[model samples]
Target: MKKRLDLAAFRDGILSGSRVVLGQAITLVESALDSDQELAAELIQSLMSHTGRAIRIGITGVPGVGKSTFIEAFGKMLLEKEKKVAVLAIDPSSQLTKGSILGDKTRMESLASDKRAFIRPSASGGTLGGVSGKTSEAMLLCEAAGFDVILVETVGVGQSETAVKNMVDYFLLLMLAGAGDELQGIKKGIMEMADALVIHKADGENLPSAKKAKASYQNALHLFPSSPKDWSPKVSLASSLSGLGLEETWREVLRYEYQMKESGFWESNRARQRINWLDEQIHYLLGQAFLRDSKVKQTMDHEMENVRTGILNPGTLAKKLVSLFLSTERPQ
Candidate 1:
């Protein structure tokens, strides 16, 4: 089994145009079991030695913003331009039953049929830490699979999809028209992270509303300092169903890419992502290792009870757990 899951052979398969193997590797990486997770991280480390090729994009939206439909249309448009696109969608709702109402493949029908595009649903397995911490590795596998563009669609919780944004070259946030809570849904902090915001369903009777929404977003965006990218975040209108403004949206994405590259922010940002990925993985594995301790397990069960009983503060309790954990370290 170890030989079968060997990272070197898997690396070769990805480089040799075997997308199936690449997909399987991502599945392994996204697994929740400890053994599988360790093997996955090992494989990803081997593959990371050959990195920095694909353009990673993270797309996030509030619920009902038509993200899946927009991805379908946008993917079709990318394939038209002869670009290979890979989409990894993280839907938190898959936690309970491992079920998705409209899984990425089913929702993005056209892209699913397109040979140049690959769409995979999140095998989140109840871990919301960006698909059990496999998202970054899966992205690397997608890049090795020769997809020039990768879109990571994050959970629509509107909380801190910040993890996805930190991994990608450009981040796109989608919004709807006449939502009444659009402004409230998109706080200044979240909007500031966006490279571009697209008002979806901008066709037929909704055109005017989309325009209004776009103007409002644009005005709101101007109030914040410019994004890390040299170009200011742009707001556009697009009808994913009618395919209106789809081309312009892609063009603006490319424009943002080029502008960032010209300003040297592109390379710097990617390097920063690499460092962050390393730090995050280290943090995750250490936490996992700490949890393996029997004392840690007992402490966890005890800490929650203490919190519930108001006998201990969360921060101080957490520090005690960590202190005990460090002091009780065994074999490395």
Candidate 2:
């Protein structure tokens, strides 16, 4: 029988640059099956100090916007430049089986084949943010394993993107020029998170359409004024399939980094994300603890039954839930 996956040896394998072990470690973190969550948590603590070196870029877009395809192209380019790229993709999985659509891996076949790139697809599994508890921790593990670029790809257009933007140094929004599409389709708050907007799949038959979309985006962007750094958001068109306009996109990312550093948004953003993360996790833990109380559980059941019977008002039900939360002394 195979020995249990050894944590100590696994840790050493990470430090020693063993890709096989690195893959296992990443899988452990991404798979939040109830049994592994605690072990993954412990491993992340051990790997904490080794993180933060990678340039974390988070990419998101609406469904069918080619996020996976763009990542494949972008990742391959980085690999050709001899950079080790690791992708932590957060996409919802089937609740029953807890596996992603697995489309990311399929789209990123080339990147997967590259020696310099590591791709891990994580099942969101009803996770609100589409990120598991160990995402940041896994990032640290990847950084420690010597990956130069750690890419956190999240499901687009909602809480998932918001969650990813909080953790990454740069947030990238990918757009496409479908028939008569408008910026109105994307929420303003999500657009505001973007450090840059890339018009993806800009090539051949799509080039002219992409250009028009780029102009429209530029016009829409003027409405946001400038970022806190006095930097106007950058917009560009790129063909992930044809490898066109990639270099400029990379340059813009670097420029954004420089502007952020110069204007102190770098540290400021990181600090804010830290506080936000702390608060979010605290609230989550508190809610979990509050619900775990036997009394609270019974109350919830009663409340739901009351709602079903039309005896309980929604507002009153919410109040009762909040009271339950408030009454509980949450453990730190």
Query: In candidate 1, which residue pairs clash?
Result: none
- Candidate 2: deviation at residue 217, Å? 1.1
Candidate 2, 81-177: lDDT as tens digits: 8889998866544353233425434667878877777777664465553254457667778888889988888753357777888789989988888
lDDT of 1 by residue, 1-332 (tens): 54455777777888775767887888887666778777777777777766668888889887788888888889888998999999886654466424342443367776777778877777655445545357777888888778999989876464437778888998998888896756566666677788888989899999998898889888887888755455788899999879998999889988877888899999999889888877877787787767877887888887888888888898988898888888885865
Number of the predicted model whose lDDT against the real structure is largest: 1
> What is the lDDT of every predicted structure here?
0.78, 0.76
Task: Pick the TM-score winner.
Answer: 1
